[model samples]
Target: MKKIVLTSFALVGLLISTSCGNNKKEAEKVEVEKEQVTPTETESTEKETSESSTIVAIAAANENFTTLVAAVKAADLVETLNSAGPFTVFAPLNDAFGKLPEGTLDGLLKPESKETLTSILTYHVVSGEFKAADVVKAINDNNGSFVITTVQGGNLTASLDGDSVILTDSKGNKSKVVLTDVDASNGVIHAIDTVVMP
Candidate 1:
């Protein structure tokens, strides 16, 4: 009888131990699932924030720059402009476009003039971020003159005269940086009264 009782007690203890081990294993699995889910959620949220911060478009503040807008779209450089770069754009207003001969804007919009138009528009862009103060400093460092290389493979001369900045193109045409440092999410825009050709 004692042997029977002893054997029954051993069986009960083994069953209890097995049941407790199973419960612990289930709890550990739940914890591991939670840990994996948390990191995935964090990574997805970070990606969304980074994408949302990018600039996707540009709006010209005047009718004169209509030519610029069309060229940007035609050159497929709209994506570059919409990127996350803090670019500095020398934006010429509508009156500046009028400086071009009549029908010039229309001609440039044609398919044949696409390449030329693209070059002209890219001549206005410079890589990296530069404010008015930085421009002035650059000019001062170069003895009131500095050369700026455009994305269009042209050189533009920047000159500082007291409080005014002058931009001269390769074609010997001059445009004053009438308004300096208009800040943008992707870059800076400087308003000029005249268009600079590449």
Candidate 2:
């Protein structure tokens, strides 16, 4: 009888010990998994941000420009825009296109109006890189204003007041810089609210 009781107690002890061992192993495994996964998640986030910047650069590239794509191709300015020489383009968003009068975009797309289209598009481009800071400095040094010569030989004058950058074209058209400092490998882009016609 005594031997049987001892065996029963030993069996219970063994079962309890086995259960505790399993629990400890499971807890350790969970901690190890979390540690292993943490760095991967952080790296993934960094990779995504890097990829987003690249996509922005590619999309801002002249060939893939949203509003300017058709016009660039129509005017055969793709090669010029994609060349090695860096350029700072005052890019107009699609909504800026909507601001134009009806039939304006269509009229420009016609083959007969190629010269006009090219000039207008080129007016948005400068020969070299000009960041917002440079523009602001030039404007301040020139009595609150500075004039830039476009690649098309047209003139674009800008004024800096407070935090806003205001632009005026040779045709007496005015535009506002809505967004700025979109970086690219080749150059940079400043998103303007209006399209300045040459």
Candidate 3:
């Protein structure tokens, strides 16, 4: 009887030990799963936040602005525009750069033309976050035209070309805002079809 009781107790203990071990493994697996899931969630949120944070980031994300992104990096204006204070960037698309005179883009990308390229790029950036509506309103308020000072120390004239906003560079070349109100944490980007000169 004692032997039987001892054996039974041993079996019960074994069963309990096995069951406890399985539960521990399951708990550990759940913890690992939780750890894996948490970082994924956080990473997604961070990626979304970073994607819309700056003009550079926004331009880099768009396939059409590859040339512009390269130009920004070339001009060393990435950090300036990516800094702060609500800049309004009139970003030119790759097709717009193609519209430049032959060898113009190539010359500008050269190391010797850094100052000139920086001036041209900075000419596209105004020191404030002006959305399309605000820009139009300012145009209207200024009697059908508004002159905005750019980061390059040049002035860009904003006028209404029908329902669209047209930006005129100092050299009399005009670039129409193809897309507007690309809100970035640092400012706004208005994609232009033409690369405005300083």
Best by TM-score: 3
TM-scores, all models, native as reference: 0.69, 0.67, 0.74
**Cα error, candidate 3, residue 91 (Å):** 0.6
Ranking by lDDT: 3, 2, 1
Span of 10 residues, lowest total lDDT, candidate 1? 53-62
lDDT of 2: 0.81
TM-score between candidate 1 and the true structure = 0.69
TM-score of 3: 0.74
- After superposing candidate 1, which stretches have Cα over 4 Å from the reference? 1-58, 61-67
Q: What is candidate 3's lDDT per residue for 159-196, written digit by digit as tens?
A: 99899999998889999999999999888999999999
Return the candidate ranking by TM-score, descending: 3, 1, 2
Query: Pairing residues by index, what is the TM-score of model 2?
Result: 0.67
lDDT on C-alpha atoms for all candidate structures: 0.80, 0.81, 0.91
Pairs that clash in candidate 3 = none
